[model samples]
Target: MKLKPVRFIFFCCFPLSVLIFLSAVTKKKPVKEALNEPGDGILLIKNTNGPTLGYSNKSGIKILSIENLYFKDLNKNGKLDKYEDWRLPVDERAKDLSSKLSTQQIAGLMLYSAHQAIPVLTGPFGGGTYNGQPFSAGEALASDVTDQQKDFLLKDNLRHVLLTSVQSPEIAARWNNNMQALVEGQGFGIPANNSSDPRHSTNGGVEYTAGAGGKI
Candidate 1:
Protein backbone atom coordinates (compact mmCIF):
# COMPACT_ATOMS: atom_id res chain seq x y z
CA MET A 1 0.00 0.00 0.00
CA LYS A 2 1.24 3.48 -0.85
CA LEU A 3 0.31 6.83 0.62
CA LYS A 4 -0.58 9.67 -1.69
CA PRO A 5 0.76 13.14 -1.01
CA VAL A 6 -1.97 15.68 -0.46
CA ARG A 7 -1.42 19.40 -0.97
CA PHE A 8 -3.82 21.67 0.89
CA ILE A 9 -3.83 25.46 1.22
CA PHE A 10 -5.39 27.00 4.33
CA PHE A 11 -6.96 30.46 4.31
CA CYS A 12 -7.68 32.45 7.46
CA CYS A 13 -7.51 36.03 8.71
CA PHE A 14 -4.81 35.20 11.24
CA PRO A 15 -1.67 33.12 10.71
CA LEU A 16 -1.96 29.34 11.01
CA SER A 17 -0.17 29.33 14.34
CA VAL A 18 -2.43 26.79 15.98
CA LEU A 19 -2.19 24.31 13.12
CA ILE A 20 0.56 22.37 14.83
CA PHE A 21 -1.28 22.40 18.11
CA LEU A 22 -4.57 21.35 16.53
CA SER A 23 -2.89 18.60 14.53
CA ALA A 24 -1.07 17.34 17.60
CA VAL A 25 -4.19 17.22 19.76
CA THR A 26 -6.50 15.92 17.01
CA LYS A 27 -5.80 12.61 15.32
CA LYS A 28 -7.00 12.28 11.77
CA LYS A 29 -9.73 9.62 11.74
CA PRO A 30 -10.35 7.14 8.92
CA VAL A 31 -13.28 7.57 6.53
CA LYS A 32 -14.98 4.24 7.23
CA GLU A 33 -15.15 4.92 10.94
CA ALA A 34 -16.77 8.28 10.17
CA LEU A 35 -19.46 7.01 7.82
CA ASN A 36 -19.79 3.25 8.31
CA GLU A 37 -22.74 3.53 10.69
CA PRO A 38 -26.33 3.06 9.49
CA GLY A 39 -27.99 6.42 8.95
CA ASP A 40 -28.14 9.38 6.57
CA GLY A 41 -25.10 11.58 7.05
CA ILE A 42 -24.32 14.79 5.18
CA LEU A 43 -21.06 16.69 4.83
CA LEU A 44 -19.30 19.04 2.39
CA ILE A 45 -16.03 17.79 0.92
CA LYS A 46 -13.53 18.59 -1.82
CA ASN A 47 -14.96 16.86 -4.89
CA THR A 48 -12.90 16.63 -8.01
CA ASN A 49 -14.31 16.26 -11.48
CA GLY A 50 -13.84 12.55 -12.26
CA PRO A 51 -15.41 9.20 -11.63
CA THR A 52 -17.20 8.91 -8.33
CA LEU A 53 -14.64 7.09 -6.20
CA GLY A 54 -15.62 5.47 -2.89
CA TYR A 55 -18.90 7.39 -2.69
CA SER A 56 -22.25 5.87 -3.58
CA ASN A 57 -25.55 7.42 -4.55
CA LYS A 58 -27.98 7.35 -1.65
CA SER A 59 -31.36 7.61 -3.31
CA GLY A 60 -30.71 10.83 -5.24
CA ILE A 61 -28.12 12.47 -2.99
CA LYS A 62 -24.41 11.61 -2.87
CA ILE A 63 -22.73 10.42 0.32
CA LEU A 64 -19.02 11.18 0.29
CA SER A 65 -16.12 9.99 2.43
CA ILE A 66 -13.74 12.45 4.07
CA GLU A 67 -10.68 10.38 3.15
CA ASN A 68 -11.47 10.14 -0.57
CA LEU A 69 -10.89 13.89 -0.93
CA TYR A 70 -7.14 13.60 -0.49
CA PHE A 71 -6.55 12.70 -4.16
CA LYS A 72 -8.25 12.85 -7.50
CA ASP A 73 -9.01 9.14 -7.63
CA LEU A 74 -9.45 7.19 -4.42
CA ASN A 75 -11.03 4.14 -6.07
CA LYS A 76 -7.91 3.55 -8.20
CA ASN A 77 -9.50 4.29 -11.54
CA GLY A 78 -6.72 5.14 -13.97
CA LYS A 79 -8.14 8.55 -14.84
CA LEU A 80 -7.25 11.28 -12.36
CA ASP A 81 -9.46 14.34 -12.26
CA LYS A 82 -10.48 17.08 -9.85
CA TYR A 83 -11.90 20.56 -9.52
CA GLU A 84 -8.57 22.22 -9.14
CA ASP A 85 -8.43 25.83 -7.85
CA TRP A 86 -11.90 25.28 -6.45
CA ARG A 87 -11.85 28.76 -4.94
CA LEU A 88 -10.00 31.12 -7.26
CA PRO A 89 -12.39 30.38 -10.07
CA VAL A 90 -15.31 31.63 -8.03
CA ASP A 91 -18.17 30.70 -10.40
CA GLU A 92 -17.10 27.07 -10.63
CA ARG A 93 -17.23 26.38 -6.91
CA ALA A 94 -19.77 28.62 -5.18
CA LYS A 95 -22.91 26.48 -5.16
CA ASP A 96 -21.67 23.82 -2.75
CA LEU A 97 -20.24 26.47 -0.45
CA SER A 98 -23.53 28.31 -0.41
CA SER A 99 -25.43 25.21 0.70
CA LYS A 100 -23.54 25.00 3.96
CA LEU A 101 -22.92 28.70 4.67
CA SER A 102 -26.28 30.21 5.47
CA THR A 103 -25.36 33.31 7.44
CA GLN A 104 -23.90 35.90 5.11
CA GLN A 105 -20.87 36.45 7.32
CA ILE A 106 -20.10 32.74 7.58
CA ALA A 107 -20.66 32.28 3.87
CA GLY A 108 -17.94 34.81 3.13
CA LEU A 109 -15.38 32.59 4.82
CA MET A 110 -16.70 29.51 3.04
CA LEU A 111 -16.02 31.16 -0.29
CA TYR A 112 -12.41 31.82 0.60
CA SER A 113 -12.08 28.46 2.35
CA ALA A 114 -13.44 26.74 -0.75
CA HIS A 115 -10.44 28.06 -2.63
CA GLN A 116 -8.09 26.85 0.13
CA ALA A 117 -7.32 30.46 0.96
CA ILE A 118 -7.54 31.89 4.46
CA PRO A 119 -8.79 35.36 5.22
CA VAL A 120 -6.53 38.08 6.69
CA LEU A 121 -8.57 38.70 9.83
CA THR A 122 -7.74 35.84 12.20
CA GLY A 123 -5.86 36.59 15.42
CA PRO A 124 -3.18 34.97 17.65
CA PHE A 125 -5.52 32.16 18.67
CA GLY A 126 -8.15 32.42 15.96
CA GLY A 127 -9.98 35.29 17.55
CA GLY A 128 -12.48 37.57 15.80
CA THR A 129 -13.33 40.72 17.74
CA TYR A 130 -16.57 40.06 19.59
CA ASN A 131 -18.26 42.17 22.29
CA GLY A 132 -15.66 44.80 21.50
CA GLN A 133 -12.91 42.33 22.35
CA PRO A 134 -11.13 39.31 20.92
CA PHE A 135 -12.80 35.98 21.48
CA SER A 136 -11.57 32.42 21.07
CA ALA A 137 -11.63 30.74 17.66
CA GLY A 138 -14.98 29.08 18.34
CA GLU A 139 -16.51 32.17 19.92
CA ALA A 140 -15.85 34.33 16.89
CA LEU A 141 -17.74 32.01 14.57
CA ALA A 142 -20.69 31.29 16.87
CA SER A 143 -21.71 34.90 17.43
CA ASP A 144 -25.03 36.08 16.09
CA VAL A 145 -24.38 36.91 12.43
CA THR A 146 -25.26 40.34 11.15
CA ASP A 147 -27.75 40.89 8.34
CA GLN A 148 -25.39 43.35 6.72
CA GLN A 149 -22.89 40.54 6.21
CA LYS A 150 -25.41 38.07 4.81
CA ASP A 151 -26.45 40.29 1.91
CA PHE A 152 -22.89 40.38 0.63
CA LEU A 153 -22.10 36.62 0.27
CA LEU A 154 -24.97 35.27 -1.87
CA LYS A 155 -24.32 37.49 -4.86
CA ASP A 156 -21.53 35.27 -6.09
CA ASN A 157 -21.68 31.79 -7.60
CA LEU A 158 -20.66 28.90 -5.35
CA ARG A 159 -20.83 25.13 -5.71
CA HIS A 160 -20.72 23.24 -2.41
CA VAL A 161 -20.15 23.93 1.29
CA LEU A 162 -18.25 21.98 3.96
CA LEU A 163 -19.43 21.65 7.56
CA THR A 164 -17.27 20.72 10.53
CA SER A 165 -17.40 20.53 14.30
CA VAL A 166 -17.14 23.77 16.24
CA GLN A 167 -14.14 23.02 18.38
CA SER A 168 -13.48 26.63 19.33
CA PRO A 169 -16.13 29.33 19.22
CA GLU A 170 -13.65 32.18 18.94
CA ILE A 171 -11.95 30.58 15.98
CA ALA A 172 -15.30 30.06 14.30
CA ALA A 173 -16.29 33.72 14.85
CA ARG A 174 -13.06 35.05 13.44
CA TRP A 175 -13.29 32.74 10.44
CA ASN A 176 -16.87 33.84 9.82
CA ASN A 177 -16.21 37.56 10.23
CA ASN A 178 -13.20 37.50 7.97
CA MET A 179 -15.28 35.85 5.28
CA GLN A 180 -18.12 38.34 5.64
CA ALA A 181 -15.81 41.25 5.11
CA LEU A 182 -14.36 39.70 1.98
CA VAL A 183 -17.75 38.84 0.56
CA GLU A 184 -19.02 42.33 1.24
CA GLY A 185 -16.07 43.69 -0.66
CA GLN A 186 -16.86 41.31 -3.54
CA GLY A 187 -20.51 42.41 -3.62
CA PHE A 188 -22.30 39.10 -2.90
CA GLY A 189 -24.64 37.63 -0.32
CA ILE A 190 -25.39 34.22 1.25
CA PRO A 191 -28.83 33.02 2.21
CA ALA A 192 -28.51 31.78 5.76
CA ASN A 193 -30.56 28.82 7.02
CA ASN A 194 -31.39 29.28 10.68
CA SER A 195 -32.52 25.68 11.27
CA SER A 196 -29.08 24.19 10.70
CA ASP A 197 -26.15 26.08 12.17
CA PRO A 198 -22.72 24.49 11.85
CA ARG A 199 -21.43 26.92 14.46
CA HIS A 200 -23.64 25.33 17.13
CA SER A 201 -23.47 21.62 16.22
CA THR A 202 -21.17 18.92 14.79
CA ASN A 203 -23.46 16.23 13.38
CA GLY A 204 -23.54 17.49 9.77
CA GLY A 205 -20.14 16.38 8.50
CA VAL A 206 -18.35 12.99 8.54
CA GLU A 207 -15.43 12.29 10.85
CA TYR A 208 -12.25 10.42 9.83
CA THR A 209 -10.61 7.37 11.42
CA ALA A 210 -7.45 5.25 11.06
CA GLY A 211 -7.16 1.46 10.33
CA ALA A 212 -7.04 -1.15 7.57
CA GLY A 213 -10.62 -0.54 6.46
CA GLY A 214 -10.26 3.19 6.91
CA LYS A 215 -11.25 5.56 4.07
CA ILE A 216 -7.70 6.32 3.08
Candidate 2:
Protein backbone atom coordinates (compact mmCIF):
# COMPACT_ATOMS: atom_id res chain seq x y z
CA MET A 1 0.00 0.00 0.00
CA LYS A 2 1.16 3.49 -0.77
CA LEU A 3 1.72 5.73 2.21
CA LYS A 4 0.76 9.41 2.18
CA PRO A 5 3.88 11.48 2.77
CA VAL A 6 1.87 14.47 3.93
CA ARG A 7 0.09 12.43 6.61
CA PHE A 8 2.93 12.69 9.10
CA ILE A 9 3.44 16.40 8.45
CA PHE A 10 0.22 17.09 10.31
CA PHE A 11 2.19 16.08 13.40
CA CYS A 12 5.50 17.46 12.14
CA CYS A 13 4.09 20.96 11.81
CA PHE A 14 2.86 20.87 15.39
CA PRO A 15 6.10 19.23 16.60
CA LEU A 16 8.14 22.25 15.59
CA SER A 17 9.73 23.92 18.59
CA VAL A 18 7.39 26.79 17.98
CA LEU A 19 5.30 27.09 21.10
CA ILE A 20 7.32 29.38 23.35
CA PHE A 21 5.17 28.73 26.37
CA LEU A 22 3.81 25.51 27.89
CA SER A 23 1.40 25.13 30.79
CA ALA A 24 3.15 23.25 33.65
CA VAL A 25 0.63 23.27 36.42
CA THR A 26 -0.78 19.94 37.63
CA LYS A 27 -2.24 18.99 41.00
CA LYS A 28 -0.62 15.57 41.52
CA LYS A 29 2.26 15.99 39.10
CA PRO A 30 5.31 18.01 40.06
CA VAL A 31 5.49 21.54 38.72
CA LYS A 32 9.09 21.35 37.55
CA GLU A 33 8.77 24.27 35.15
CA ALA A 34 6.34 27.08 34.39
CA LEU A 35 5.80 29.61 31.63
CA ASN A 36 3.63 32.64 31.16
CA GLU A 37 2.58 31.50 27.72
CA PRO A 38 -0.75 29.83 26.97
CA GLY A 39 0.45 26.38 25.90
CA ASP A 40 2.28 23.52 27.63
CA GLY A 41 5.99 23.08 28.42
CA ILE A 42 8.14 23.87 25.39
CA LEU A 43 11.56 25.54 25.22
CA LEU A 44 11.91 28.77 23.30
CA ILE A 45 14.41 29.70 20.60
CA LYS A 46 15.35 33.34 20.38
CA ASN A 47 14.24 35.16 17.18
CA THR A 48 12.67 32.01 15.79
CA ASN A 49 8.96 31.11 15.40
CA GLY A 50 9.26 28.53 18.19
CA PRO A 51 10.56 25.00 18.85
CA THR A 52 10.51 21.93 16.66
CA LEU A 53 9.13 19.75 19.48
CA GLY A 54 7.90 19.92 23.02
CA TYR A 55 8.68 18.18 26.34
CA SER A 56 6.39 17.49 29.23
CA ASN A 57 7.62 19.31 32.29
CA LYS A 58 6.01 16.65 34.43
CA SER A 59 8.23 14.10 32.68
CA GLY A 60 11.31 15.82 34.16
CA ILE A 61 12.85 16.48 30.74
CA LYS A 62 15.25 19.38 30.64
CA ILE A 63 16.11 21.46 27.62
CA LEU A 64 19.67 21.08 26.30
CA SER A 65 20.60 24.12 24.29
CA ILE A 66 23.57 23.61 21.98
CA GLU A 67 24.40 26.39 19.55
CA ASN A 68 21.03 27.32 18.03
CA LEU A 69 19.21 23.98 18.22
CA TYR A 70 17.31 22.72 21.26
CA PHE A 71 17.03 19.06 22.25
CA LYS A 72 15.15 17.21 24.98
CA ASP A 73 16.75 15.45 27.97
CA LEU A 74 14.20 12.66 27.85
CA ASN A 75 15.97 10.35 30.33
CA LYS A 76 16.33 13.19 32.90
CA ASN A 77 19.88 12.03 33.87
CA GLY A 78 21.22 15.65 33.95
CA LYS A 79 23.23 15.02 30.78
CA LEU A 80 21.84 14.68 27.24
CA ASP A 81 21.30 11.05 26.25
CA LYS A 82 21.98 9.64 22.78
CA TYR A 83 18.33 9.32 21.86
CA GLU A 84 17.60 12.90 22.82
CA ASP A 85 20.66 14.24 21.07
CA TRP A 86 19.73 15.77 17.71
CA ARG A 87 23.21 15.14 16.29
CA LEU A 88 22.61 11.41 16.01
CA PRO A 89 20.66 9.68 13.28
CA VAL A 90 17.02 8.76 14.09
CA ASP A 91 17.72 5.02 13.65
CA GLU A 92 20.64 5.24 16.05
CA ARG A 93 18.51 7.13 18.49
CA ALA A 94 15.70 4.63 18.18
CA LYS A 95 18.20 1.85 18.81
CA ASP A 96 19.48 3.61 21.89
CA LEU A 97 15.97 4.05 23.22
CA SER A 98 15.04 0.47 22.37
CA SER A 99 18.10 -0.92 24.09
CA LYS A 100 17.09 0.66 27.38
CA LEU A 101 13.42 -0.29 27.14
CA SER A 102 12.26 -3.38 29.09
CA THR A 103 10.45 -6.24 27.39
CA GLN A 104 7.05 -5.10 28.62
CA GLN A 105 7.74 -1.56 27.50
CA ILE A 106 8.64 -2.81 24.05
CA ALA A 107 5.45 -4.82 23.90
CA GLY A 108 3.50 -1.79 24.93
CA LEU A 109 5.24 0.33 22.36
CA MET A 110 4.46 -2.25 19.71
CA LEU A 111 0.75 -2.28 20.56
CA TYR A 112 -1.21 0.40 18.73
CA SER A 113 -3.71 2.48 20.60
CA ALA A 114 -7.10 1.65 19.15
CA HIS A 115 -9.88 4.16 18.51
CA GLN A 116 -10.32 5.96 21.82
CA ALA A 117 -13.10 8.41 22.52
CA ILE A 118 -12.38 11.10 25.02
CA PRO A 119 -14.99 11.48 27.76
CA VAL A 120 -16.56 8.36 26.28
CA LEU A 121 -20.20 8.87 25.27
CA THR A 122 -23.18 6.57 25.81
CA GLY A 123 -23.83 5.33 22.30
CA PRO A 124 -22.08 2.47 20.48
CA PHE A 125 -19.77 4.27 18.05
CA GLY A 126 -17.91 6.99 20.01
CA GLY A 127 -19.42 6.23 23.40
CA GLY A 128 -17.92 3.94 26.06
CA THR A 129 -18.24 3.20 29.77
CA TYR A 130 -15.55 3.89 32.31
CA ASN A 131 -15.16 1.17 34.95
CA GLY A 132 -18.30 -0.54 33.64
CA GLN A 133 -20.26 2.66 34.10
CA PRO A 134 -21.28 5.46 31.76
CA PHE A 135 -19.11 8.59 31.70
CA SER A 136 -21.97 10.59 33.16
CA ALA A 137 -22.40 8.03 35.93
CA GLY A 138 -19.05 9.10 37.43
CA GLU A 139 -17.52 12.48 38.15
CA ALA A 140 -14.99 12.45 35.32
CA LEU A 141 -13.68 15.39 33.37
CA ALA A 142 -13.87 15.53 29.60
CA SER A 143 -10.24 14.49 29.44
CA ASP A 144 -10.64 11.81 32.07
CA VAL A 145 -9.55 8.55 30.45
CA THR A 146 -11.27 5.21 30.44
CA ASP A 147 -10.23 2.13 32.47
CA GLN A 148 -9.13 0.30 29.34
CA GLN A 149 -6.90 3.19 28.28
CA LYS A 150 -5.09 3.02 31.59
CA ASP A 151 -4.68 -0.74 31.26
CA PHE A 152 -3.01 -0.44 27.88
CA LEU A 153 -0.62 2.23 29.06
CA LEU A 154 0.23 0.75 32.45
CA LYS A 155 -0.19 -2.98 31.91
CA ASP A 156 0.57 -3.37 28.21
CA ASN A 157 3.37 -0.78 28.46
CA LEU A 158 2.13 0.69 25.20
CA ARG A 159 3.65 4.06 24.39
CA HIS A 160 2.45 4.64 20.86
CA VAL A 161 -0.96 6.29 21.18
CA LEU A 162 -3.53 7.14 18.58
CA LEU A 163 -5.87 10.01 19.39
CA THR A 164 -9.28 9.98 17.75
CA SER A 165 -11.26 13.08 18.76
CA VAL A 166 -10.59 15.81 21.28
CA GLN A 167 -12.78 18.41 22.94
CA SER A 168 -10.43 21.32 22.47
CA PRO A 169 -6.76 22.21 22.17
CA GLU A 170 -6.44 22.91 25.88
CA ILE A 171 -8.18 19.68 26.85
CA ALA A 172 -6.01 17.70 24.46
CA ALA A 173 -2.83 19.21 25.87
CA ARG A 174 -3.94 18.43 29.40
CA TRP A 175 -4.75 14.84 28.46
CA ASN A 176 -1.32 14.49 26.83
CA ASN A 177 0.40 15.65 30.00
CA ASN A 178 -1.70 13.45 32.22
CA MET A 179 -0.98 10.38 30.12
CA GLN A 180 2.72 11.21 29.75
CA ALA A 181 3.26 11.64 33.48
CA LEU A 182 1.53 8.36 34.22
CA VAL A 183 3.83 6.39 31.93
CA GLU A 184 7.02 8.48 31.92
CA GLY A 185 7.29 8.15 35.70
CA GLN A 186 7.63 4.38 35.36
CA GLY A 187 9.74 1.84 33.47
CA PHE A 188 12.84 3.33 31.73
CA GLY A 189 11.19 6.74 31.28
CA ILE A 190 10.50 6.24 27.59
CA PRO A 191 8.24 9.03 26.32
CA ALA A 192 5.03 8.20 24.54
CA ASN A 193 5.11 8.84 20.79
CA ASN A 194 1.57 10.08 20.29
CA SER A 195 0.21 10.27 16.78
CA SER A 196 -3.12 11.06 15.15
CA ASP A 197 -5.24 10.28 12.14
CA PRO A 198 -5.31 13.14 9.66
CA ARG A 199 -8.28 15.51 9.66
CA HIS A 200 -9.12 17.26 6.43
CA SER A 201 -12.00 19.35 5.10
CA THR A 202 -12.51 18.70 1.44
CA ASN A 203 -14.60 21.76 0.69
CA GLY A 204 -12.51 24.38 2.44
CA GLY A 205 -8.84 23.39 2.00
CA VAL A 206 -6.79 24.24 -1.08
CA GLU A 207 -5.97 21.57 -3.65
CA TYR A 208 -2.50 19.97 -3.93
CA THR A 209 -0.50 20.41 -7.12
CA ALA A 210 2.42 18.19 -8.14
CA GLY A 211 5.80 19.61 -9.00
CA ALA A 212 6.82 19.78 -12.66
CA GLY A 213 10.31 18.26 -12.18
CA GLY A 214 9.07 15.22 -10.22
CA LYS A 215 10.51 16.70 -7.01
CA ILE A 216 9.05 17.19 -3.58
lDDT of each: 0.33, 0.60
Looking at candidate 1, the ten consecutive residues that score lowest on lDDT are 207-216
lDDT of model 2, residue 99: 88
By lDDT, who's the top model here?
A: 2
TM-score of each: 0.21, 0.55
Query: Could you tell me the lDDT of residue 24 within candidate 1?
Result: 55
Q: What digit string (tens of lDDT, one per residue) describes model 1 on residues 135-212?
A: 333443343332223333344333133322333545444444444333323322222221112233334333211111
lDDT tens string, model 2, 1-216? 335667776667675534422322222222233222335553333313333554455556556554434565666676777887767888998999888887877777778876665556455645666667778876677766678777888888887876656667667667777777666656556667666555454343221111111111
